[model samples]
Target chain A: MSFTMTKHGNVVVVDVDGQLIVGNRQELKQKVLDELEKGERKFLIDFARTGYIDSSGLGVLVSLSKKIREQAGELRLADLNDDLKTLFELTKLDTLFQIADNRDRGLESF
Target chain B: MAPVRERWPSAAGSTGDPAGPDAVRLALQLEVPTDVRLIGRIVQLVSRQARELEFPAAICSLNVPVALSEALSNAMLRGNKEDPAKRVRIRVMVDPAGLVMEITDEGRGFDLETCTQDPTTPANVVREDGRGLFLMRRLTDRVERYTEAHGLARNVVRLTIKRPPPADGS
Candidate 1:
């Protein structure tokens, strides 16, 4: 997976593209960790272009959410396709993090 | 001559009678080394067939490939320890009732019950692992694990989707 980081007001937006799986999840995790090190907490991960995700991807996102929350930072995901949305719901992860329909809404929420 | 080896019931055969007219049977078997890149190829095969079978939007779009990839990853990573010398076998069978994906690996198997920790818990949510099993169980209809006579560990995941009745009107 690849991430392009931008700022929408105070929320940091990380747009991810490509398949998010075990082989590439670590790059996304590291990006989040680097942002955390920079003391930028609020995060919005835009998944509009991501075609697929696997268990490793979910685990990475969960870990990122917890780490940000522990630091009093917020993380919200946006633009998940129907398939990904269902996956989040099926895994009960929808209850764990804030999910929005679009980047503007996700940015506005934080 | 050595006794002919029969396919195991635990394999990805039809839960219902496969010969029935209503059953649209499609099967594919793949044997690959413990390489993560090969998973993309398997996903492509599964996703293409699932789409052709006209499975429901969700089943065709995500669940099948995701669950199958997880099973394959486990077979490659945990079951085979990413050993290039080892091989992982993946069998996918689709029938009218549902789809069955069986993955076998050449390695010493662990106790599935003991190894899988619930990732949904508050304390364990941030562990960044062990969620593969959770996702497989949640996404598929039924999952079975066994140690075959070949000293291989086989993980079978079955997903039930509603398919149209046979075109001939059986």
Candidate 2:
């Protein structure tokens, strides 16, 4: 999977393109962590092009959420399809995350 | 007997009742080292086979791939402890009814009852490690574990998902 980052006001919109599974989850974590280190706090991950995500991908998201929260920043997810939405619901992460219907909403929330 | 590492064509030419005379069944076995990189390739191969066999699009695209990736990761990381010498064995059986996959890892197995906790609970929502087994159980219809004792004891996670009956009338 690849990450395309764009700046909309203060929020950094990260577009994940392709499946985010075990193979490349760490890359995502590291990228977000690096961004956090650079003082980019408000973050939104756009899953419009993401096809699939496994447990590892979920784990990375959780860790990133926790890390971002610990830094007094925020993280949001947007554009999750039905299958992806179901995954978050089943894992109870939906309650933990501020998920938006689309990128604009996600950016606005931050 | 060594596990055959090959893909076998469908025993029955048509997708029908597995027990019926014209039942369709495809089998594949793979033995690979403890490498996380191979997980995607294996998931893709299985997902493609399921789609070609006419499994539901959701199952072929999302459910199977997610469940299989979790199982494979568990086998490689937790079961084998990432030992390069150890191998993970996969056996896949697909029929018109559904799919059954057995992931065998050459390591001491743990009790699934005690090992896995509800990741969705308030207490464990932020925990990163336990969700793999939970997702495996959630996405698939059946998630079972058994230890084979023929030569060496090996832990096998058997995942099964049955095809849902068609919607009412037309």
Candidate 3:
């Protein structure tokens, strides 16, 4: 239900705490869009603390990815649990985003 | 908000219980306004009930929450159009076989065949909206939609998830 932003080198890591679904998806979108407006382009969404994400959460991620790409920026995701990994795979979004094993790897990749 | 309504089946109807003849079927029903914020609480309630009924961890923790959230949000946003006067009715039945949930929304039904597009398709991957139905179908064992015409016409989404066979092949 919370999104915490931090900077590591050029990557702006957004850590998602708690489940991401319809109720709070708009907050996440606004936060990321605000960061995008500030010219912070390289983004990594860390999901280590995230319990789960419903379809609305996934939609926001897709929308954010598209927006970031339009601005010539990149977005990556890391630390998704097994269930979440399966979700991305099932939706075929695994191919659309660059996913890393952890935050460290995600930062390095950027 | 109106209080949740629950109904339990009588013991005499347990003749074909999946667990045993003595098993009692559990049911929970709720009617909430068309609000997205209530999705989490409802999901938690159903998830806890599934766990208490000895459903598998995967189904209790992930599948049920994700699929139920989708169904509820769909009912609130698309079915009911976020009408404040409208309400979403949820009924859950849990037995040893699995869980069955019915979500009824007070709205005219749409054609699921025409509305639900494959979100995985290359053209639709970035659409950001059409994946709810796809995820619900993929995560649950069954997803069915139908319209009820008694009084006000409404749409019902019935989802089912069955318990897997025991590991020892029992």
Candidate 4:
């Protein structure tokens, strides 16, 4: 997956592309966790190009969310297509997450 | 081996067809590592098909289509050797009662009963890899396996799902 980190003030807007599968899970997980450690907890994930994310990828999201919340900050996801949106909803994560409809909305929340 | 001819049983019966076939054949294909794209495609297919066929509200609530994608990920990522040429056949069949999804790989099958246990619950939730089966079992009804007419031993999985009540119980 290809990711672009554009900083809107403290909010790290991550634009991701390609299939977010098992192959690149660790890298993505580490990158997000590392940023969270650096005190950049505000995140807006754009799934515009992300084709798929398996359980591992979902784990990273859950783990990262937990970590960020522990730090008193938050990770908000935006632009989740129908497929990914259904996944989070099916898993009952829509209730747990601060999901934004678009980038403007996600960034505006911060 | 037999060139893979999948035919829908005219109607559900104990003798000719399966225990029952609320399961309608949605699509069939050889699953490859690259076929991960099909994951979303399959989920989308099931949603549209189920709605058009008027299967049941449970079909949507149980969300077997989503679980099917995760199962494919396990078989393609861990089960098979990840050879592009080593294809895994995916069959998604849905019945009014529920949906049955099967992914037949060209590799050896592993033990299901062992992996079904949630090792990480109170003991080791921190561990990885063992989580896939946990998620699958949690999402689908009953995940089981047996060889199709192809006689492909120990390399196939049959996940049977009982339709769930509507999320809001409507």
Candidate 5:
């Protein structure tokens, strides 16, 4: 997986591409946490290039969300395609985080 | 010499029969672009075929297939090891009285229980990994991992979704 980080004031937009699975979970989680530690509470993970996600991917998201929320912040997922959207719904995670259809709409919320 | 069979149930009312001796018809490989719709399509196929052999929705086989698909994704594409073109072999069959769903991969086999994915805990839900196996256990009646007799270390996973008793009052 490839990760690209871009900062928008307090919002850190992390763009993930390719398959997000077990092998890359540690590096991905650490990157998110490192940013979270710097008080960048709001996160917008754009899945524009992400093809697939598995258990490890989902777990890291959940853990990171908690980490951010604990610091009085929020985490949002943007541009998740229908496939990933169904996964979120099936797992009932669509109810927990703030999911938006596009990046502009997602970042604009905060 | 009879082929090894593994069986289990699902959580949804997925009516799939795994008896009567009919074998599963699964494509021998992973055809890229693993999306939710494709996953649902495969789940539907498994659910339909399993129900045909009498393993009806008494165990929610629908969710079980999802879990299997998750495992497939992990074993197939997660290692930057997408070279040589891997194929995920899925077979569904019954032995004596057990319903089995088997997925054989062309990659190196790994441990299942040691995985650290937690879908129930929302805090860890968005990490991009770890939820597949987590959900697999939650939605299926039972899940087990073992090495195939051929020494291929194939991940022999199964879901024994039971069916409701006949309504004839017999």
Candidate 6:
């Protein structure tokens, strides 16, 4: 998977493209952690183009969310399609993360 | 030794299609390393075949792939411990009845009954691990775990998903 990071005001939007499976989940996790380490918080992950995600990918997201929350930083998700929304709901992660319908909404939440 | 085809009578009975006209059976075997990329590739290949057989996108693209990914990861990562010297064997069968995928790893077997945890609990919700087996059970129609006594004991995870009828009513 590939990620493009762009600044939308104070919130950093990371657009993840392709499937987020075990093979490439660490890349996303590392990037998020690096941003966190650099003191850049208020993150929004854009999943509009992502087609699929396994439990491994969810684990990465969970870790990222926890790390950011622990540091008093905010993390939000945007543009999750039906399949992804269902996945999060099934795993009960929807209750743990702040999800928005679009990028603007995700940015506005922070 | 001849290839053994141990039909899952339980799965057949569940689908209520012991032998139907639309039941076409095909089996594929692959020996892959403990690489996640290779596992994804294998799942993609089988998913394409599932699509060609008129499986719905929800099943072929989403449900099957998710279940297969979790099962394969467990076999390759946890079971084989990412040992390149060890190989993971994947056996896939698609028939009118449904789809059956068996992933065998060259690791000591574990009890399937003990592989579950409550992911919805408050304490486990934020954890980054321990959700693979849960996802596998949720996404597939049936999941069976056992050990095969070959030269060395192999951990086998069998997943079965029934094919949905065509949307166009064909």
True-structure RMSD, every candidate: 4.3, 4.4, 4.6, 6.3, 8.9, 3.1
Clashing pairs in model 3? none
Off by over 4 Å in 1: A70-72, B1-24, B113-117, B150-170
Task: State the TM-score for model 2.
Answer: 0.90
**Could you estimate the TM-score for every candidate?**
0.81, 0.90, 0.91, 0.63, 0.53, 0.90
Better of 4 and 6 by lDDT: 6
Query: How well is each residue in A52-108 modelled by candidate 4, as lDDT tens digits?
Result: 566777777777777888898888998887777866665556666788888998889
Model 4: CA > 4 A from native: A1-6, A15-41, A44-53, A62-110, B1-38, B55-62, B119-123, B126-128, B147-154, B164-170
Per-candidate interface DockQ score: 0.55, 0.79, 0.79, 0.22, 0.20, 0.74
Give the clashing pairs for model 4. B22-B95, B23-B94, B23-B95, B24-B94, B31-B88, B120-B124
Model 5: per-residue lDDT, tens digit, B10-95? 32223554444464332222243323224445545665655565564533243444565665555456521454355555665433
Per residue, candidate 6 scores C-alpha lDDT tens digits across A1-110 of 69889988888899989889999898999998998899898899999999789989999999898899899998899999988988999889999999999998888888
Candidate 3: TM-score? 0.91
Q: Which ten residues in a row have the lowest lDDT in candidate 1 chain B?
A: B5-14
True contacts kept of 4: 0.11
User: What level of docking quality does candidate 6 show?
Assistant: medium
Off by over 4 Å in 6: B1-17, B20-22, B165-170
Stretches of model 5 off by over 4 angstroms after superposition: B1-69, B72-101, B104-155, B158-170
Model 1, range A46-104, lDDT digits (tens) per residue?
99998788998888898898899999999999999988988877667888888999999
Ordering by lDDT: 3, 2, 6, 1, 4, 5
Shift of residue B164 alpha carbon in model 3, Å: 0.9
The CAPRI classification for model 1 reads as medium
Tens digit of per-residue lDDT, candidate 4, span B1-170 = 67775555222322465434354445444444535545555555665666676656534533455466677777677666666666767766655445667787766677776665653454434333455676677666677765555555537777766555556987
What RMSD does model 6 have?
Answer: 3.1
